[model samples]
Target: MAGTEIFGIEEIKALTDVIERKMIHRYGSHSVRNGIYRVEEFEEKAKKITGSKHALALTNGTAALITALKGLGVGPGDEVITSPFTFIATIEAIVACGAVPVLGEIDETLGLDPVSAEKLITKKTKALVPVHMFGAAADLDPFMEISIIYGIPVVEDACEVVGGTYKGRYLGSIGKCGTWSFDPNKTLTVGEGGLILTDDEDLYFKMDCYHDHGHIHSKAHDRGEEGKFGLGVNYRLSELQGALGIVALDKMDATLEKIRKTKKRIINSVKDTGIKVRPMHDPEGDTASHLIFMLPSPEAAVNFSRAAGEAGTGFSIISQNTWHYAKHWKALEEMGEKDIFGTKAPSYAAETMAATEAMLSRAVMTGLNINMSDGEIERIIRSVKCGAKASL
Candidate 1:
C-alpha cells in the first residue's frame, strides 16, 4: 500500500528524462551492461540507506532471494529453514535454488520462532531465511546467535519491512544478507524491481555475478570486454526501473512517516473498542507499513472481517489469503519423497504450522498507505469501530 500510487510528480518527469537520456546516448537496453549511470547510482544509494557495504539491483524480489541463495552456495542437499506464515516467495526461493525448505513455527511475533528454527537445524542446514512480514522486525538477536553457533548464514526477506529497524540496527543489515522488493505494493516501487544488500564483499560479488550472467565486469573490462563467466542467469533491472527506484528511494522516508502517523491514529481510534486487539509484533522503534491486530478468537476475527467488509473497510484475514498464507502453496504439495538433488524433501505442509495457524486464525490486517487521505483514514476508523461493535 505504501507504493501503491504515485507519490510525486517529479518521479514521472525523472522517468521521462531517463528514457530520453538513454535514447540520446545510444545506450540501447544495456542498463546494467553499459554501466548506465542510474543503475549504479541507485545501488550506491541503496547501500548507503541500508548500511550495507554492497548492494545490487535486480529484476524482482524473487530473483533477489534466488540470487542470494545461490551466492551463499545453498543448493541440492542443503536445507533452508524459514517461516511458514510468509508469502510463497520465501519458500519458492529455497525451492528454486534446489534446497529443501524446512518450515519453522512462528512465535507471537508472527515471524520464525528462533527456538523452532534451532530445533529444525541439522547437519544439512545451510541457511536460515527469516521473513520480516508486514514491516515488523523478527527476533533477529536470537537468529544472529544461532547463525554464529551453527555457522549458518541468515538471509533476511525484508520485502515488507524496508525502513524498519530492530533495536538500533536496521532489519536487513542485521542478517548476513538481506533482500527488499520494489513491487507495486512495497515501501518503494520501481514497478518490478528488487535489491540485495550485504556487508560481505565475496557474497556480494557472487550475487552480482549470479544476477548478471556470471560476468564479473570492471572499469577496464566493461560489458563487451573479456571477463570470467560463472553459472548465472539474467536478472538485471532496466534503466527506467533504476531511475524510478532512485526517485522512490529519495521519497521513502517522508512516505513512511506519513503512513506511520496515520497508522498510529488508526490504532488509537480502535483502542477502546472493548475488543481484544494487539499487534502481531512489537512496533517499538520501527516504521509500520501495515496495521495488523489479533482478535480474541477465530470466530471473532471472521465476523469482524465480514462486518468490516460490509462497511467498506475490509481487512485481510492472514490465514485465508492465498498469497501470504502457507496452506495454499501448491508447490509444497508437489514435493515428492526425493527431489532432483537426491535429498529427501522436508515433511513440511500447512498442518505443520500449528502456531502460525493459531495466530493467523484470529488475525485481522490492513495495509497502510501514504496515499490514503484523511477522509479515507476516518472512514476506515469508523468502519473498524462498527465492525468491532457488530462482532461483539
Candidate 2:
C-alpha cells in the first residue's frame, strides 16, 4: 500500500498557473533577492492557520529547526533537552548550533516526559524542544510550565502534526516557537518546504534573517539597501514551493478530517484484538496522523511486525535501536568534533534513556494518509487482526 500521497492535479495546475504568472510578470528573483508574491501569501496563510503572529518559510523542516534554535540564541555550552523518540532532525538542530542535546524520557504520548525533562534542565540548558510526534500533540502544558519555571524557550517541533491541537490551542501556537514540515510525506506537502511560526517579533526577525542568509529585511532595509546582516545560511523556500504550499494549505482542513476518520476506523476495528493501544493524549485534540499500538513484549513486537509484513499491513515496529530513536544518537560518534563555535560536543551515546527505549521497543505504528481509500483501510484492519492472531 502507498504510505503517503500528494495533492491532486488541481493543486498541480494551481502551482503551474502561479509559476506561469510569475514568469510573465518577470519575477526573476528568488525569495532572498526579492519577495516572491506567492511566498508572502503562503507565509500569511501559514500564520493564520497556525495562529502565530509571524510565519517564515524555509527550504525544509531541518532548516526550520536550525533557524528556530539560532533565533532563540542557542549555541556553544547550551544544552537543549528533547525526547529521544523523535526524528533525528530534532537532535541534529540542537547539535548544529554547537549545543548539547540532552535526551529526555517519553511518556505514553511518545513525547518528552515533562518531569524527566525538568530534571535534565541545568544552568547550561538553553531550550526545550518538544516534538508533536506522529501527529499527536505532546503534553505541552507541563512543558510550558517547565519553560516558565526555568526561563528556557520551548520550540515545538510540530512537523508531523500541522493542524493538531492541545487543549484547543494549536500545537505550534503554544510554545515560544513552532515548526512544520511540508515535505511530500507530511499531511501538507509542498514537495519540500518548512515553516517557522512565532509571536515574538524579535525572534521572528532573528529567524527571518537566519533563513535568508542573515540579511535583515524590514521597512528601513529594503531589498537593495544594506541591512544588519548576521551569521546565517541559505534556507529560503522557492516561489515554486511557495505556490504549492498555498494550495496545500487550502486543502489541509478537509484532508485532516479524512485522515482522522480513517484513523478512528482503524483504531476501532482493532479494539478487541487484545493488543495494548496507547490512547492519544487528548482524543478531541490530536490530529490522528498515524495509528500506533504496543505489543506485549519486544519479541512479540518483532513477530507481529513480521506477520504484518507478510499480511501486507505495512505496519512498522519502532524500537529503541531505530535510527530516529534517541538512544541510538551516539552524538559524539555521529557529529564528531566539527564545531562552528569551538565547543566540545557532549557524549550522548553513553547516556541510555531506559524509559524511552522501553516505551518504543514494543510499539507498532503505521502512517495514516488522507488519500487511503476505504478498501485500503479495511485491508489494514484485517491485516492487523491476522497479524495479531498469528504472532501473539
Candidate 3:
C-alpha cells in the first residue's frame, strides 16, 4: 500500500545531492544553495501532472487540508460536509478550523452520497468535501452540481488516490481545490509531505502565507521581513522531503500502470463468481492500488473474509478497518455525541448510516503490490477463488 516499495538509488542520490549541498530549507538560502529550490520544483511537477494552476507543498496531508480550509475562510460556526468513510484527518482539519464536520452517507462508490450531502446542508454549510476512496474516484458529477447549486466549494480529498483521475481530469483538479498526501503509505512517498492543487491565484497566495509563519515570501525582502498575511503555522515542507518528492512524482505513471495491471488481473479472475467489484466514477483512470469486491450481504462478506484469511490471503473488511472508516472513530463519535458537529448526537451506529453501513459492511478488499511476484499473484488468485466460493 505504499510507493516506498520501489524506492532505490534515485532516492538516495537525490537525498545525497541535498545533503552534500548542506541545503535543507525550502526557502531563502540562495548563496550556499546555488539558487536550487526543490520544493518549488516539486510543486511545479505536481501542477503539471494534475493540470492545476497552483500547488502548495506542506508538511503532511492533514496540514494541506487545514490550510485549504483556512484559505477558503472556513472557521467557527461554519459546517463542512464530507463523507463518513474517510481518514479522520478530514474531520480533524475542519475541527482545527473551529468548524463543524457534517458527515454524509456513502453510496455504492463508497464515497459521499450527493443526495445525502445536499440534504444535510444548512445556511452554515461552508463546503462540501468528496473523498476519493482507495484507488478510484467517488461519483463527482453530482457533488460538482451540488457545489454549484449551493454556492459551496468542493474540496477533493484525493489523498488515497494520488495518481488517479476522474473523467479524464485529475481527481484533485476537478474540485475548486484538491489535496493529496505523500505519506510513506501513499503511492507517492516523500517520507511525509502534502500538497494542495488549485487554479485560484489569490487562494494560492493565502495558503502559501498560511503554511509558513504568515510571511508572504519574497526574494528581495528576506525571511520575517516580508509583509505578513495574517497569523499562520509551521507546516513548511523541508528541502529534503522536496528532493525525494521530485523522484517520487516521476515514478507515478509507472506505479499506476503496475498497480492497475495487478488489480485488473485479480478482478477479471473473480468476475465469474457473482462477486461485484467496487464501482468507480472513472474506471479507466483508477490508480487500482486495491482490489475491492461487494458481497451479496454482510454475512457473505464475513464468510469471504474468513475463507481468505484461512487461505493466507487476508482481505480487509472495511467496516472494521479503523484507519479508513468512520464507524470505528471513537473520538469523532464522542464529539458528535456532544452535538459539536452542528447536529444533535450524530450517530455512527449501523442503523443511522444504513446505506453506507450496508455497502461497507458487505465489502472486502486487499491492497495490490507493485512488485508482486508471479508466485504471490497465483497464491492470491487461488485465495480469492476460495473466498468467492465461500461467499457464494
The local distance difference test score of each candidate is 0.81, 0.79, 0.88
Residue 37's C-alpha lDDT in candidate 3?
A: 94
lDDT at position 113, candidate 1: 86
Backbone clash count, each prediction separately: 0, 1, 0
TM-score of each prediction: 0.93, 0.90, 0.97
Instruction: Name the top lDDT candidate.
Output: 3
Q: What would the per-residue lDDT of candidate 2 be over residues 75-186, giving only the tens digit for each residue?
A: 8878898887788998889878888877778887688889989988889899999998877888899888998988899999998788888888888788999998987777
- Please give the ranking of all candidate structures by lDDT, highest first, separated by commas: 3, 1, 2
Strongest candidate by TM-score: 3
- Per-residue alpha-carbon lDDT of model 3 for 305-376, expressed as tens digits? 999888889897888888988878778777764555454545555456677888899999988878898788
Kindly indicate the candidate among 1 and 3 with the higher TM-score: 3
* lDDT of predicted model 2: 0.79
Candidate 1: regions farther than 4 A off: 1-4, 23-36, 280-282, 336-340
lDDT of 1 by residue, 1-392 (tens): 45757556877787888776653221223554445567778888988887889889888999999999999999889999998878888888988998898888887777888999999999999999988887788888899999999999999998777778788667777799999889887878888999888999899889988887787857654477647558799898877888888898888778778878888888898889876655444576456776777778889888888888888888988888787877777767568355647788865566677788998888888777777888999988987888798777
Worst 10 residues of 1 by lDDT: 23-32
